[model samples]
Target: MDVDFGGADDILFERSGHAGIVTLNRPAALNAVNHRMVRALTRALAAWEADAAVRLVVIRAEGRAFSAGGDILDIYEAGRAGDPPFDFFADEYRLNAAIARFPKPYVALINGIVMGGGVGVSFHGSHRVMTGNAVFAMPEVGIGFFPDVGGSHFLSRLPGGFGLYLALTGNRIRHGDACAFGLATHSVPADDLPALLRRLCETGDADASLAVDARAVAAETEDAVMDAIARHFAHDTLDGVLGSLAADGGEWANAMHATLMARSPTSLRVTFRQIRTGATLTMDDCMRMEFRILSRMLVGHDFYEGIRAAIIDKKSTPHWRPAALDAVAQADVDAYFAPPAGGDLSLQ
Candidate 1:
């Protein structure tokens, strides 16, 4: 059986065999999730959850990228026009929570670029399948945003301080690294993906269809790197982390120090707090925390400035307000975690 709920065509939903299938369509947009796509996906997942015929759900995307993230251009325009799109974030956050709480097996087939919003959708699911070509990153700090979309939950939980390292640096990682870090449950070759999909659809058994393909040499090397990451990022404060990196006097340390220096100062500090606080909270609480941050970020100066430089103008040189980490006040960072006037995100 197959089902199609038509709308903007940015996403497609269908039922195949025992698996409910979701294909991120809008390849030209790199499957960047917009408000419409979020609502559609939420509705589809809800419907499938109640349908006994649908034993599991499989999410994949068109084109070379799984998803680059959310539709920041839409967000940018809306915010610039003075109407912050709060509903979008609310609905999206609810969807993220719903996915996290979903009873059925949720399999995400990630073969290409997966970043901020992309991470929100796939990483929350039960099965995160990465192909050889997969590339993953958080990258939100670079855009003057913290890693939202339950990043506070999952990123905080990644072992050996790797999640904190990823949040601050926003570095793109490949299959080997993702596997080494436990971000990916299964690593499949591109050529084998089709067969894997077929088997999944036929059997609806995620564990049975999946096979671990992490390279021993790569995992061995990554273990060493994780040790370095754990050491440098072990500090409670951003300043302490930077000091650790500086004292090392190594090439990698120098590059990491420079990368952190380039990110928006406000974003860096807020993310540090977000990751730290998230470690102690539940997934739902983490989503609420991200909502609080989003409320502040959408109204702040740096997010727009970041969009202008990185996306609109392509200059890649955002002049962030407060410019340096020391200039970002503790009080201001504290405000981001506070509840919004409208209210906190109420998840169903």
Candidate 2:
């Protein structure tokens, strides 16, 4: 196995015959992604795509979590320094878009926690494999920001109202629910993954055989909990959703209500709008919209405060401005979705 780019010890890259495997190497942080890791990953993928000997690329992570998410601590530091936060988002988003549209066969072995920016890298792959341990979500709303990193595109594509439900609630989808929501292609036992990867590599016909086996494995572990998800997540507003759940009076409903109450109200409204708007948008359009919202959040909103309280202060309490959901006016939410002074996100 050959390894390149020694600077990013947090990201491990190696080649096994015709297969290229990229592992997120930060186990202590649950493989959370930082700027250096993102840059290294982008470079590695580009190199593998160009290499004649590399027939496939596998993106997996070390530790119990695939990735906790993007390095929010870095974002907090940039915000505190009064730096234009758009720079980080722009670079990260560009990397995600590249992966979504990458030409070669991309396989994301989603073995554990895959959330927020984690989903951005792993979900768009041609072959997305999940294990019994995988837990997925877009918890950006909890941090007083709308979901980004192409979240608008993929979450919007979810069936029924599941997209909007997740955007606002920061709901955690387990391995079964992930398959039911179309967030993952295959669901195999965690133990089966290593052998599956080896088999796919040795199959010679990398593209066709991998796809066939991956789909079969996923179908075999199909989630029967889709009805419950659909029933709980179909409501339009947060209050309505809660009311419906409360009326049911089940333990699951109580747990879900607690989850929703813990997140930022303003973020929920903005995220709801983001997913709805994104549902009708192209990949470029989704990125552009998210970029606009995130740019504004950097300068004008309580994103810094949210990060400070939850991560820096370790308080778990975020005092959001216009704290109540009803206090957040339509105009205020509209401003986040509106175009920035410059324009939409551009590839160049």
Candidate 3:
């Protein structure tokens, strides 16, 4: 294994033939991506791009989970210390942009719990391989944050308004369901991952691995589910979706209502706008928009409280600032969309 770029080994990079491999090495922490990891990743990506021998890249984690998420505990402490989380978001979003615009073929092994920041790394890659253990989700709303890291761009493009539902409710999806929802491209079982990686490394191309026997994670949809999603989430307003859920008597509707009611009202309002307005924008635009929202959210009351209740205290109950959903007004939500303090995020 070749170690380069300041010799930080938390995010390991190596060259084997024509492929560059990245191993996330924080098993004890569920391979959570911190700013240091982000910096290491940034350096590796740039180095590989410049290296002539590197034809492809593969990113996999060394724990039960591919990644838990960004270091929320760090952010929680930052909040307590009266420090702003500006630098973390700035770098993390830049890394997401790098992944999105990477020239070479990028392959991600989605093995275990893949959520939040994990999605930014894997979801934007050229190839996303999900195994039996893969559990995909974007639960930022539960933490009083909207799905950033180009979420607005990708989620908005998901078929049948389902992105809106996932963004609001933070539902979990398995490997099969992930493929069906455009989150994964292949569903190779866990036992076969080693051989698949070997072939990918050997040929230095994803096509070689794709040619091998594996289940293609096709984007197939059920009519009933799509219809229900449309009925509830198609509406432009969160209140409309809530009204639809309340009117419907099915278990699915009831469950979704409970989840939505439990989420931060301001977050729901902002996220609803994020995904909806973001659907029409490019990936770069979506990231820029997220930067604005995140800047506002950092100083707000809900993010810290949500982190305290969910991570620190384990209470799982966050009394959102706007206690009632309807209390969040259009003006309140619009304030987050205003230009960020440091100016918009630039991929350059």
Clash count per candidate: 0, 2, 0
Q: Which regions of candidate 1 deviate over 4 angstroms?
A: 211-217, 220-224
lDDT of 3 by residue, 1-348 (tens): 676655275678888878898888887888878888887888889989998788999999897999978879988899789897788888889889899899999999889998888888788989888888888889999988889888998899888788888899898878777788777888888888888878878888797786684686543346776689878999868889999999998998898898899999999999999999988998888888999999999999898889989988897788889888879888999999999867887776
Least accurate 10 contiguous residues by lDDT in model 2: 215-224
Question: After aligning candidate 2 to the native by TM-score, how far in Å is the CA of 286 from where it should be?
Answer: 0.8
Off by over 4 Å in 2: 5-7, 204-258
Error of 1 at 243 (Å): 0.9
What TM-score would candidate 3 get against the native? Answer: 0.96
- Give every collision pair in model 2: 186-218, 187-218
Worst 10 residues of 1 by lDDT: 212-221
